[model samples]
Target: MRLENVSVRYHRRGPWVLRQADAEVGPGEVAVVLGRNGAGKSTLLQVTAGVLRPTRGRVVDRPRHVGWVPERFPADQPFTVAYYLTAMARVAGLSAAEADRAVDEWTSRLGIAGFRRVRLADLSKGTAQKVGLAQAMLRPPGLLVLDEPWEGLDAAARDLVPLVVDEVLAAGGRVLVSDHRNETVRLPGARRWTVAEGTVTETGPDEPEDVAVVEVAVPAARVAGTVARLRAAGHQVLRVRAAGRARDGATPGVGPRPPAADDTALPDEVAR
Candidate 1:
């Protein structure tokens, strides 16, 4: 999808929140929107998600099914989690049975199964965030737009953010997310869009710095969790290989060992 010379303002004579913001994100790619509070990050995301109309310019080639998760989910609704998700699924072009199945599937996947029958207004902030995420994924869209997806989520839920992005990319879908908490380090190879003073500019990933690579020996069952932790901590994991085996050797049940303590290593920030 592409936004050409996009500009937005609340009123005709009001100041523009975004000006001539030209940006594009294609299938199988993820773009991160970065900016300080009140810097038009949410406005850009709204425009990208087709939730808000731009005062000038236009969006082209946007997908028909666009999944948008706003910064603040409206949890004051009277519908239960299951009911709300099912209704949204239908809106996303699912049949009655399909919508029921989708609601069950996503509620389970997002760890909100117990709250399926609970009213949205009664759920906690984190649980409400989970519902927000689950609804967006009930029917995968060609373009997925998230605004501060990590906000109000627990640690485990926060870790799921990258996995969701991976799922979208694997399905050849495009993703555009805005974040200020630096919690998106796990989204490897994501293009960066920095917004400042109602202007947006794209920046490619930084060049890899000279740093030592460390390999930790974790049990096979624990590898996924360990990798997620490392990535969340701003560490760039080089690769994962079987223990005591060559890089191209057959996979083993156990993980590889860590580097010797004497090895020179740079801080995780440098690697990021």
Candidate 2:
């Protein structure tokens, strides 16, 4: 999938959020989009996902199919989790029975079974986020645009989300995700794009330093093991960082912190 000189304007006579933003994400490749908070990262993902139209340029999808999950899901309805997912499955071209089965399988797979019968409005933010993932996987469209996909998940769920993404790519699916997490950098051979000042640049090995931060959530007991895995995989270990203050004697999951975006930069994880 590629965008040709794309630009998006939210209002008349206003500046475009993205300007002359060209990008290409290929099959078997994942590209990480980066910027500081409120820095148009999410907007770029929207344009790629076809949810937003470019004001001046065009987006072309080689496969002609795309799956999109936004920063916040549109689930303010009086529907059960199963109901909403089943509806999305139908939209994805699944038969009623097939959608039911998919919902069953995914809810179980994502460990969201307990919330299956609950209404979406009553669910917590993390549970809602899991539903977003389920919808993306339910169809496995050619291109996936996920924005902060792991925003509200617990540590176990966050770890499992990457596994789902790996499965999507192994099956020849392409994904574009922007999150406040470093795990995005660890995907093998995934491309990187940085957006700022209404322009986007495809970051290669030699790009100048901007901000370097990676977010991971890991239990204290598993820090050493996780670090070993990342190092073996050849990622710059930016430290086994954790977010939020921990209670007395409790293991904290690693959280995201800035890291040099250069692929060759080795960052020591700020182990908590």
How many steric clashes between backbone atoms does each model show? Answer: 0, 21
List, residue by residue over 153-265, the lDDT tens digit for candidate 1. 87678868888888888999999998877777767678899999999998776665566555467766887899777866778666566575534443454343344588655
The TM-score that candidate 2 achieves is: 0.75
Candidate 1: residue pairs that collide: none
What ranges in model 2 sit over 4 Å off? 204-272
Q: Score each candidate by Cα lDDT.
A: 0.84, 0.77
| lDDT of each residue in 128-188, candidate 2, tens digit only | 8888888887876788788988788776676676677787788788888887766565454
Model 1: which ten-residue window has the lowest total lDDT?
Answer: 249-258
